[model samples]
Target chain A: MTGASPADTAVQGTVAQPEWQQLDRRSIWVAPVQPLAGLLLAGLVAITFRGWDRFGVIEPAIGAAVAIGVFALSAWHWRTTRYRITPTHVEMTSGMLVRKHRSVARDRLRSVDLTSDVVHRLAGLSVVAIGTGRQGGESDDELKLDSVTTEEAERLRRLLLDRGSRAPAVAVADPGGPAEPAPLARFEASWVKLAPLSIMGLVALAVLAGGAAQLARSVGGDEIWRSGPVRGAWDWVVATPILTVVIGGLVGLLVLNAVLSTVLYVLFYGGYTLVRADDGTLRISYGLLTQRSVSIEERRIRGVRMDEPLMLQLGRGARLRVVAAGLGTKDGEGKEKKDSDMLLPTAPAAVAHRVTADVLGTPTSPVGAPMRRHPVAALRILLLQGVSLALVPAAVLLMLALVGLVPHWIWQVLLLLVVPAVVGAWLEYRNLGHARVGEFLVAQGGPAGRHTVAVRTDGIIAWQFRRTVFQRRPRVLTAIAAVAAGKGTQTIKYALQDDVLPVARDCVPGLLDPFLEPDHP
Target chain B: MRLRPPNNPVHPRATTWWRLQDAGFYLVVLVVAAGALFWVSTAWLVGVVAVIVVVGAVDIVVTPPIRYRKHRWEVTDQAVYVRTGFFVEDWRVAPLSRVQTVDTKRGPLQQWLGLSTVTITTASTAGELKIKGLERGFAAELVEQLTAATEATPGDAT
Candidate 1:
């Protein structure tokens, strides 16, 4: 391990690379493949040329011309863009007609992520996206350095966030001392089984199976059904008894979803690894094809979230996520969701707690903390919502049945479902709970998922309190703790007036001073 | 049916602000009702309009005072506390450190009445907290104090 003075390194860096460093030549190749829409458009054109009646047979020369044109245009775009890096800031100069010069200070830089798609991987290049810790509507704060060499991408990740100097790029001391990063956590084989248990998986399977059936009926013709494997499965379905077939199909679909989701999980997170960098940053790299590396600064992470999906909850499985800012949360980018604040995919309950404790630097598990329950008003509201919603159909059917306009069975069916509706609402009210654990506030609730989010109180930026008309009678209101990180707001619905104030006081202490009269929520 | 709120309420002059806004609303409604007066077949539409106008007139006259009483706010060294709404009251407390922007807006009607709306923005998902119908001078003072407080607090580590 070498500890080079960052100041000395900066002086040496200017002589070698004067102002800017040019990207790899392979970027020109990647440029054409960058916009996914272009590829999709090309596919559409090819399909229409072959299948559409009006298009008829397309000449091969026209196809080649379009391909060459797109590639040439992309190359020209690549030629125009340039960038410069100093110890303090990274400056970018892009665009030909409308010039764009974006400069980001090294200290202000939030997170550096490297991503590679099928095209980028094939070309041995990666796209780097650097984000600033700014909220939405501040889009210009991010820098997208596309199609850099894989090695350069790695170097940039370390250098841009070096904090010390541009020349002494790597950290001075190798604390871990391992030739490779010691894997803090890895996806267990059992995580695949969780895919089947989730409602989303079941719903997706149903949709897929329905689509296949529809496709078989309308498009592909009898030859598709005669295919060897599908034929065997179809024959078995037909041979079984009607009741057996119905039950077996459901079970089969669940199994298929489990296997499918597991395969999907493995493909995305097969070599999943969370490594602690020498500088205390947690660097995560994963995915089978579209390799991605995400770096989160130690201080940026506020807390952890534990989600127990209903199906997975039964089996003691949970998913873990980090509560942090500067992780892309807006809906526009598909990359954000893929590489966002994910700490772990599905894992056992114990493992989830262990990882959370490790991340927060706590000796005890994050789970099993005592929580404060909502007032009875919450239950009343839930029951009102559930019963009133369920009764509307029942009343309509009953009225129609009295006039002999509808069958009596309709009313009976509606009546039969009412109990379950009320029970579901009650369960939701029962789940609503909030607690203050040391410097963290745990907001937990939900009928199905039972989401438990533990956020550091210091990370909370504001508090919003609500007092509804119905809740007034029971002296209860809702409190929303807004943080700059993650989903942004944590809610504690139907809290008593006495309870919420203390919670607010605990979260922000002197933020809501005693000078102000006791507020509603 | 009202929820018990904090002691410090909005400016007493806010009733004038509410009444002015209510009058403007009623003016629009009256214009439409007058136009409809000629087209009704059985005069039932006119009857309904008369009933609505009467109820609205009562609401405009009686509700402002209730609203003024319900609305509350207080500024401490570290945060801004506000409770508003005559029916569904909402209370908000935002730390000075989290304060991103602060502004005071005065609409034409409010300008005539010497009143302004104070808006406090934080990095929270709940959006902005606004205390409407404060004395113009008080609102300005609030903006200045809040801005100073925000600047004094250190950078958010997040």
Candidate 2:
């Protein structure tokens, strides 16, 4: 209902602003629209199939009408939808039947990320994704401009950043100093090739094998190539114990695939650059198939993580990821989604740390100590597990004997439960240790493989001391550490009751005091 | 760290009531289980009536004389402390700095009694601390106090 106001038409700088009418008209068919239309058509066709079974003659005509109706609705919606960016806010108005209008204040804008797929490229239009924090009770804000020129996107970004400085909480650093662009670090796609290839290939092979097995079962038939002599021969070839000779042949093929994909992606993202723009914005641009450019305000980053998988660790390579608020990186569990903030999948730890520091606006020091389960706690855990396992089987056997159902196998059942319980208890005992380093507490415990959960003193949301009836008598308690990662909580449990309070205090000063009174202490 | 008298009248006698109620609940559960067991043992319809009568008599005898001791929170500059437990006595304290949000609610019974429940949420993993059965006027005052403290304090990152 509101037309573009006089303020919206004001162009910054001397750049000539193209008349709104001159912009590409085809931008209406954004990435989602085409797929959505296609889905609607498919649904119509399915409806037609049901109609044909009921009333044969009118089905085809009805299907055609339905298809036309869907297409018309999509076109109508696309034509009516419009977006504009003023210096103060980003405005979007859409919906044909039910008109909706939304706007985000420029100052509240935290980041702008641009992504385009094949469909977007073909249309010669890109999507500008704008993110903003919640103010008042409003939760999340995102604005996606369906069709916009690259130049227009850049102009909008600059204008928003310019206006953002005026807001109360938005602080804009001065860009007066001589621009010292960091030396462009050249990383060959070939250097860290083997790790991704082998991992991906193994996963692919597993998936293919699973699919093939499922298909074979469903068909209830086996082909000669898949299940007969050829399969056996293939298995024998792969099973050869000469590790060097066998893997040596496959390594080239694996590396080639990895390098090929990486090179393709790099080529598509030819002008890939991560630079601090004049206004202190971290701008990252990359594209091969569909170009992507993202700019994030430095202060918005909450934390940084350097992740090293087993193979990457072995190769002395670590991936860097930034934990930026309002980035929408979280999945259902509030864990950061994979491929989100993947600055570099395989970079030197030093470079990773430097980048992380620059992005997060903090010193790149590891914040927390790894917590490990106490040795005595492990023994107790083992005992507890052993008792639980023993009791379950003992109860089952006693019930069976009382019912005269399986009285003969009571001793056998007891033996079955006891042996495994003893082994499991020993495994549990071997995996407990807790330690404090500086202001971080690290707790490690599990069976066989250990998990070390580290928490910074300041990051802990709350600490709880829980004791069961048995534990209270033993003077033992479980301490749980809660950390806020996006929406959900990350909890770390330590089963050492005796020394947990003191260690927690040392790691996180003033943590235990709030829960305990001075007079009582 | 001055401690003021509890805003709500602390009933020390409630502890006895709490113990009795807990015991009574367990006793009722035991009687029901016993009645079921006796009914299973007996084949005659009259035996079932006998089992029911015995359970009812036990429940009636154990129903009264239940009382519960209560404690109320006294807010300090740094923390709010509430001490209330029967056999396993425990005290809870929540710091103002760590407090994320303060919520107040009154249930049907609490409303009838002019009492309210105050919940304090912290960033800590322990979740939230709740102090219930405080006077309505006291709860409002506590909310106002906590909200002001939260706003006055600078955001602590670490």
Candidate 3:
């Protein structure tokens, strides 16, 4: 199919410009409110410590004036900032002292993502983020225009996509025609949405149990709950069940948590709808508690991974997480968060593959061989875990012996650690495997759960073969693969014959060329 | 794509300095671990310190050499060749046409010693090929050369 060129898509009809309107003044309050909240809390603490009488009437009046001044200054700054979307580009200029101007070329725009939190929604404004593929000689290319009208945002999206289609290209088609939108996938909310409810219920139960234990202790003894340690045997008896029942309740709560989690997942993802725009952008709108709309361009996706939790694999449910760069949210620490990169929560394996192929243009290939660890590796992991557990009892006995109170029945502690070690090792043995299916390399291993990480060779940014002197003795090596996301690194520890390195080296370059080569696919 | 010889090859002079620095680092780590073991009585603390020192030393000593015997770079074609390591050797072939940016940096010591480092970032991965201990002029020239090559290539409309 020939895509419409930017020139052909340019508006041929008369262009209408909307009247310049100022956003709601209240919207400006958000920026200042954040800092003000901290200041207000600090002021309250100081006032409480000093006492109202200590400050007199002047203190209250001064506090009120200072709060108002801070709010006013923030509001003024917010009002001065302005953003405009024209037929050619989206421009924004903000700042009171050092003015900043950002203009995103409509013809170069990839996609526009709009997000609104509770405050933004109440103020009827949204944060708009326009993604532009890597630009030459520019470090910061993504333009984010916060606090804009929903209508203006829509217009900007249309303008950018329209102009982008007209940019010079080898092949130009009917750009004036409306781009054909991709078919929207319809989904329904399922009972699995109740998962959150179950989780909340468990939390409530724990809170109640703790409260009950405190009440019992208060009535039984004159001692306060916070007062030092319990000395009497009766006190120990009372606290032990309080702790046991709480711990036991949590253990019992897991099944319910899983069920409730599943329910909640079903509720939100049950009626999921993913639509594709004529301009080749995917729009995902889902959720029950808080609905979210995510728009991503087809070219923006780096890779797709299909995950099957043990339970999900049995029931035919798979989680699809997309590894896309740029589309992420910042955490409280201002570091970019990875959770936002997920394109799909969970879907059938077949549906996940279809979405991957359609959105990412990845060739349909069989899942790679399951990469597994050598049997010795599992034994090594088990032995390490066993030793760690055994150390606890050994330490306890050693401490007792040092104090001249060593018990004759120290052998009982050894039995306590060995059983779990044996069981854990068996679990580890069940979990490791790796495979190479066509161009994709899949690796899986862990304890009770398996993590199958699959990536196309082209998507790999770097691969390193590492070996320790000890590992070399055992003829084992580790392969670390790096992806585009600044996420650290994923290493696959495996044992292979010495002759296998050449084969691996040859296979890796060919697979990674697509991702590493600038012009070749 | 026209490929050309690499402009910045690992200087033979830098290898001796690198080896000396690596050895010094390991020696300091060994001394610290031995001191900590003698001072700390806590088993956990001692164990942790021992693991850290041993792993750090082994990692430094066993790491592949920094020098690349065969290196190539083509400014016109936008590609680079880097072959490194002593025993388990590796060859990295990257294209500047695919590179997103070229970052040049110099630490205090490197600056005083008249050396800089260049990192070439690509779109698919964060891991970039880093060439260190190059003369400052060469690093800047490499950046300018790579930038010109990148700009010359026709932008992909996709």
Instruction: Give the higher-DockQ candidate: 1 or 2.
Output: 1
Clashes in predicted model 2: 29
| Candidate 3, A175-228: lDDT as tens digits | 334654544355634424323333434555567667656554533334334334
lDDT per residue as tens, model 1, A1-521: 11223343477445444356566678877767655454455446344434544353454456567778887877776877777666567788888678888787777777788888888998889988887777656232577888788877776777766665445446553423556666678766767766556555566667877765665554344645566776898888788899999888778877877777766677777677787776657887788888888888777888888888877888888888888777665422433445467788777888888888888877765544878988887888888878888888989999999999999899888987779878888878877888888888888888746888888888888878787677777878787888887777888878776786677776787766553354434
Q: Candidate 1: where is the Cα deviation over 4 Å?
A: A1-18, A31-55, A58-73, A138-141, A164-181, A199-252, A331-336, A390-420, A513-521, B1-8, B22-55, B156-158
Report the CAPRI category for model 2.
incorrect
TM (chain A), candidate 1: 0.80
Judged by whole-model lDDT over C-alpha atoms, candidate 3 comes out at: 0.55
Candidate 1: Cα lDDT at A33: 62
Which portions of model 2 show Cα errors greater than 4 Å? A1-27, A33-77, A80-91, A96-107, A134-141, A156-180, A183-296, A305-320, A329-338, A341-375, A378-490, A495-521, B1-74, B80-100, B122-127, B154-158
Instruction: Name the better of 1 and 2 by lDDT.
Output: 1
Find the candidate with the highest lDDT and give its number. Answer: 1
Which digits, one per residue and each the tens of the lDDT, describe model 2 over residues B36-138? 7766755554565566566655544443222123355557687655654333333344556767788998765566567677888764324567776666887
In terms of TM-score, the best-performing candidate is: 1
* Clash number for candidate 3: 44
What is the per-residue lDDT of model 1 for residues B33-141, given as tens digits with 9 covering 90 to 100? Answer: 8778766645777787888799889989999998988788777666677787757778777766778889999899889889999998887545578899888998888
C-alpha RMSD between model 2 and the true structure: 9.1
